[model samples]
Target: MSTAVTAGASGAPRRVPATVHRRRWAILGVLIFALLVVVLDNSILNVAMKTIASPAPIGLGASQSDLEWAINSYTLVFAGLLFTSGLLGDRLGRKKVLLAGMVVFGGGSLLSAVAGSPGQLITFRAVMGLGGALVMPATLAIIMNVFERDEQPKAIGVWAGAVGLAIAIGPITGGLLLQHFWWGSVFLVNLPIVLVALVGMVLLIPDSRDPNPGRLDPVGVLLSVIGLVLLIYGIIKGGQLADFTDPAAWGTVAGGLAVLAAFVLYERRAEHPALDVTWFRNPRFSASVAVIGLVFFALMGVTFFGAFYLQSVRGYSALKAGALLLPLAVAQMAFAPRARLVVDRYGVRATCAGGMALVALAFLGYLTLDTTTPIWVLEVIGFVMGTGMAHVMPPVTVTIMSALPREKAGSGSAINNTFRQVGGSLGVAVLGAMLSAAYRNGMSDHLSAVPPALRGPAGESIEATLGVARQLGPRGAALVDPAKESFVHAMHIVAGTSAGVILLGAVVALVLFPGRLPVPDAVGAQPEAEPEAAPAETA
Candidate 1:
């Protein structure tokens, strides 16, 4: 029941085959399955951060910045290649690109599983990100092609739900694997899922592509990759030293910004720009993307500190830490699919603003968390955060997707995800830096009792401090309470920063997102609104 698509430049549109139409739901299922693996790999890594930082036999002995790079490397590559991958999928045939992405992703996962050091893991994670860049846009683009406008909201809602669910549950899966197997098991776990996704892709999915695709713009792609890498590297380095005064810190960031600025100029002048910068001219499109970026910025930053808080400070096993994330997952799974109903009733501006408010409230809850804060309180925060996010993603995604023509679905999805990954990557780097600076400041006086030679390393993170304390025997035992207190204080600063960012997103949503009528017609929710989601031609 493969899909029969129109010719690349056909004048006549092809009717979707009845059989293919019937299997559209199944196709969506496989697409989400593929989506899960990409998300799971990262989410799983979050819980394993503590274990990964442990010495030699127990873990990779990675530093906090090493862990940050490990996460950012994947995100950078994913964000950098997303637009190009979207273009490639639109040009070279989506199913082919999807299959290739799966194979590459599987290989990356295997390599990461055998990674002997943080450097190797970081490199392999980038490889996985490449595959992800191909997989993500294709999934959404294909959904746009197969489903009718009326059905798109529902299908995309489920897709978005799966994304949140995968992110939420990834830690639990990682915890289970870490408890019984090894830290590498987190990466290894992806292999089987990739295998299943590959089989499904081969069996159910169909090939389709844009009739008139834009130029590949290899130069733009290269610039984006280099600029983002340089930027993230500088941020992580600044965090590592706990200072931006060093020339290496400010200089690199300056170079990255200059490169990015050059990339933008080149794009504006290019005959066929990789990213159509004009897309941002549409208030709805730009607003939605900005909100997405800010939300991710807050979420990713907070979650980075969350792993340490759950395991390093609370003394929870990886399994227990994973379990504690369940309320967030439950909230996402329960509300994501139904979020559209709220949008249909209350409109985009009000709904998203409301959701952002919930997210802000949740971040504030983190400030109250301490060495012995009740686990249920964290659960409540997770649920609130997840519920808010569920409402936000679907509406914004629908707007982004609907703004573009059906043939350009790949590019549309790329724009949506690019901001998302960029925001997340930056959030981790920036917040990770803040966390480091605050923790080091708090730990400085406390660390004088420790041997001078080890103080630098001990103040790097709670994991480092705890590991050092263990190595020091009785003398190190005295450092435990101080380390926990310092970490909690650092976490508080990050939590507050995250809350501020979320509020900014709320303001953006409230100000820039257009209002709509109470009821959406068969055509769209708000035809008169900015960046209307018009009914696209069926291929």
Candidate 2:
């Protein structure tokens, strides 16, 4: 019956209607469904790429770079716009923005289904990314607002689990769709899910926004978007070229970093800042972010190449490849709920470190995989990796969300998701570059005896190499066997590198995260030097 006063982003108090608390759990279900759709869109395209690029009735004639762009463009735009979108939601009602995002995302998917060219598909995917940016942060911010501090970790666990669940299901769903219909089926599948989320969100979710919402920062938005686009562009180009020495590659990367640095400087001094950079000053926040980024870095990189290894090198159908990944999904879903309990008992630092250790162990196992490695071996390793990911994500996400004041939840959620998207993009770029370079070099040495014209395509990609092999008939064995060997060697190199990065993250988590979650009263408590500001007057 009474309104509860809560601190706003400006440290001013604002009244939250008591009725808002009653609908929290039902609201969480809607947020999770919304989250599932956005997260699934990120990976569902992976298994559908080959079909989309195939020649004839559904031919897109997409080159390797085009295929990579189809994926990277979405992530790049999503990462770039997240901070701004979150701030917009805080200013303009999260529920309003979330519903709008669903419309945009659904529209993009529909456009993508009928796209006649690779360029059109890439453009539509970017549109979807814009919608995803709007959707992702609001889900987390709404969860923070609805759930009380004590209930947050469990709620966040379910939210985090939805992400893992989407990752697990996206490929299989795409595989099944591709089997029954065309490649466009993958994008089209989002419609029914989005429609359901829209209706549920409209009915169950309450609208919330900053009571003291400040002036918009257009400069900050511009700089962040341009910088992220350039940065991601350079990374993707570097991977494609396998040569960072190119002036264009290094120049873009340097310029992007400089612009981002400028954006940070501008934010700190801006009267109405879009992001609170001071959050990173907290060791727990910084460490949790680092752990999240590193985990995704390794996981995304492995998934990017691993899918190809299964489908291309091992000669598995897309459907079968998707089925094989089931072990990973199962392990992740099974472990995520229990991870919070582990954090409650052992502490955030221990749980995260243990998770990273398991991930490193899984990567170590992957190093042994080759053309002859059995499917069972991969399934077992995938299970191990998934379990590790499950452990790392839920606790780390809870830690980050827990560290922030309720008013800053939108920006905080955006920052966390931004790091994750950035990490995944970089992971695919860096690890893919490593794989590309190694594969090219290995193929070159073996193919030196072949005609120069035929050798070029063979060296460019595994798919091209296989095509060359097929055309050569009986003579193809010479090129085929060596190409497979080269791919295996390249995969091993990337796997080993990923193991090292995750091990470093484990060390960082151990060093930085506190032994336990902060006490409820201490969580996001304001500084003693700054007394509580007066509540913002209701209109």
Candidate 3:
């Protein structure tokens, strides 16, 4: 049962126990179990929002603004601290940080479940966000330490699959929990996952850190957290208002950008920088992160609208809509692990670009969607999109992690995640605004049926119009068809626009990603006793 492990993170190969290598996949599984709660929490909340907003005994009677803050607070806090948390993981130990994060997150989840007021829930959610920030980077960083270079992609694919699993089941899980229990049950669900993850981390994962971490860059860390908080908050606000020109949104965004610029400057001069800003100079690294941002931008924006399409336009319940998304998740689960094979055969550029092209095809399918489109067709389109993303994420992640030395995996993971979050934020803000404008334009004349007092709000969204219509009794019937039609039209317009962006990403991949992954020289002479030496045919 004894085996030698070559820890990937040290500047030198740190010889360790063979069990670290033998149970590497199990360690990854535990990490993914931990990640499942965090990643899916955002989407799972979508189903439970109305319940959370209900009056007491059922919910805390949260207002629209409170609800917005409840969500934004978590996202802003989580994004803001990612860089710092990653740095901490490097300076301290990945496993230690990971364990601490799980404890905090679990505590926050318990607090959130029992909250007496929306204010408490929001505050507790921020605590959860902080914990999530600490947890996310450490998982990937640990993966970098545990898996050898050739096997990283396969391990990462399994990691990515957990995200798809969360996506596939989050809404259904939330909806079911809400149906049988109090609104708090949605949050309480994290407990089991956290508990299992904690146990696994304790038993399976070994801590690893940067052997030569330099002096702490407190200034760089401060600047990064401050900038990301402001930037992400601004993006949320812009999406809410559906306009970036508003001083409240644009001003904060500009400030965030400026502070980030300053952080980069400070890091360049710092003897011990939190991150190597020069990584951006490498076209391979830069392009990989860029594609991550672009792909998520398209994915998140479209998915945001997709929920509305299912709920409001097609009149599906949250549970049913969530179930419809299952095919997408399944496709990612099936294909993400296999994407490396495609990359190995065709090279990074071809595989990535081809994936993006497939995503474009999915968007084109989106363009064909109608209020009356069959459920199976929606599932098929979703599967296609998921398949495309399965290919896109793993190779790009490999490229980014490969470019950085293993010891910097935490920072590298942070960079990858930061770009993804920001890109998704930009997508939701920009594409949401476009959808609003198009819907408003399509509803212009049809809105005459709405009461003068309700007309402005009715044009805002299908849900709003339907709310107004419900009050009008028999006369309100006139608004339903137009609202649905206008929304469908807007979805098509956005779908076409999203397709264009995905195609652009394909071009970026072709031009910038490394031409092909060179066959690792160790492929042929790998010793059987050494666990890290061989390609994992299956993770």
Backbone clashes for every candidate come to 0, 0, 1
Q: Per-residue alpha-carbon lDDT of model 1 for 37-74, expressed as tens digits?
A: 99888888878887899999889999776887787788
State model 2's lDDT. 0.82
Q: What TM-scores do the predictions have?
A: 0.88, 0.92, 0.94
Q: Candidate 1: lDDT of 145?
A: 72
Sorted by TM-score (best first), the order is: 3, 2, 1
Model 2 residue 311 lDDT score: 81
Candidate lDDT scores, in order, read 0.82, 0.82, 0.85
The candidate, 2 or 3, that scores higher on TM-score is 3
Better of 1 and 3 by TM-score: 3
Model 1, CA-based lDDT: 0.82
Candidate 3 residue 145 Cα shift, in angstroms, is 0.6
What RMSD, rounded to one decimal, does every model reach?
5.3, 4.4, 4.4
Residue ranges of candidate 2 with Cα displaced over 4 Å:
1-18, 522-539
Candidate 2 clashing pairs, residues 3+ apart or interchain: none
lDDT of 3 by residue, 185-261 (tens): 88889999999889989988888878778888888889998989889988999988999999999999999999999
- Which candidate comes out best when scored by TM-score? 3
